[model samples]
Target: MGFLTDTTHMHIFTWVVGIVLFLVAASMANGTKGKKITHMILRLFYVLIIITGAALFFKHMTIDSMLYGIKFVLGILTIGFMEMVLVRGNKGKNTGLMWILFIIALLATMFIGFKLPMGFNFFA
Candidate 1:
């Protein structure tokens, strides 16, 4: 548990890879095998992101429980919007709203994450 609690590097890496995979999968043709494979890998990253994020959240939760709680919810919403966008796109449905929501949530999550005491203090 010390390794997980020591730093935010693992959590950051998972989300960055997840975002890259999401873009790659989203840009590919929906019905293609490549897209499906990428999507599966992206889903694995999603799980990794949640696990690492939860570990960090629990580790530093005592500092400011309410803020961390908000960050956790925003992180979940960001992931949800990402999945919705990909699924709706694959189904040939409109995904404009989901994309908008995804961007907003992602930006908000990143901002709050940086502001937190544990991570890099770029905001400070």
Candidate 2:
């Protein structure tokens, strides 16, 4: 439990890997085996991100609960947009709107996350 107690580093690592994987997969041709494999690996990273993020969220739940709650929701939306963009793109459907929403949600989530008491105080 000690390793999981402070998950900020783990959470950041997961998201970084996830983003890289997303870009790799997105660049590949749709319906290809390599793309599918990369996507599956990316999905695993997504789960890791969520689990680590939840741990951090619960650990800091007492400090500015409202802001943490908002961060949590926005975090979920960010993940959702990431998945939507990939899936829709892979299906050969237009994902322009999803990409815009994904960027917005990701930026908002990161901004709030860094401003939180548990975060690195980059905003302060």
Candidate 3:
């Protein structure tokens, strides 16, 4: 119960879960034998990420509200780009733009996350 209120723990938990699920969804999206279930699972993971992320955001927001807001927008864009890539890939359509967007969103998200106060320091 205490961990539920611990923003650091919550952030780590959600990050790992979201990343693992994102990888799984990406793999499934690119597979020739894909299933609708993969989309459903991805959607579930996205919802989980949002919920946990909201908790983390509300609990740990700093005086630099603009930076936090940027991180927050990047987080949502990350999810949106992910879904775009999945959709376009599943349809066997050109996904270059989607891939580019996803990569940019991911890098931005990670960069901002690491720079934020109380955020994860992968080097440490």
Candidate 4:
């Protein structure tokens, strides 16, 4: 449980993992032939993402701040919504509301993730 010493490695890994999760989840939503398999993989991928995130947070526990706390809560909501959609088993319902929330959360995550100047620097 060490901080990623090489920022590049962390960035690359995160990108790869995120894209894979997105692809799998999207494919499942699109009614892929192996929808069940894709769903399972997506679930596992999400679990890993959360676990790794928690580990990183623990590593930097002293960095606790309102921004990080908010992000954590958002992440939890994202995962909860994802689970709900997966279990609902109705394409139309899943695509309508949950997917929209998922996309919004994803975009928000990206925005905060890069520390983009979105009118504030919460990490500061």
Best by TM-score: 1
Q: Of the pair 2 and 4, which is ahead by TM-score?
A: 2
**Candidate 4 residues 1-124, lDDT tens each?**
4444213245336545755665566556446657767677767767766766565444443554555555556666767666666666534454558767876876676555545222235567
Q: What is the overall TM-score of model 1 with all chains considered together?
A: 0.96
User: What's the TM-score of every candidate structure?
Assistant: 0.96, 0.93, 0.80, 0.66
Task: Give the TM-score comparing model 4 with the true structure, all chains together.
Answer: 0.66
Candidate 1 clashing pairs, residues 3+ apart or interchain: none
Instruction: Using lDDT, rank the candidates from best to worst.
Output: 1, 2, 3, 4
- In the order shown, the candidates' Cα RMSDs to the true structure are 1.1, 1.3, 2.7, 4.7
In candidate 1, which residue ranges exceed 4 Å CA deviation? none
Q: Write the per-residue lDDT of candidate 3 for residues 31-110, one digit (tens) a residue.
A: 55544676777688788778777777777777756677788889999989888877887778987898888889889988
lDDT of 2 by residue, 65-117 (tens): 68888988998998899889889998889999999999999899999988887
On TM-score, the stronger of 1 and 4 is 1
Clashes of each: 0, 0, 0, 0
Q: Which of candidates 2 and 3 reaches a greater TM-score?
A: 2
Which lDDT value does model 4 have at 92? 49
Clashing pairs in 2: none
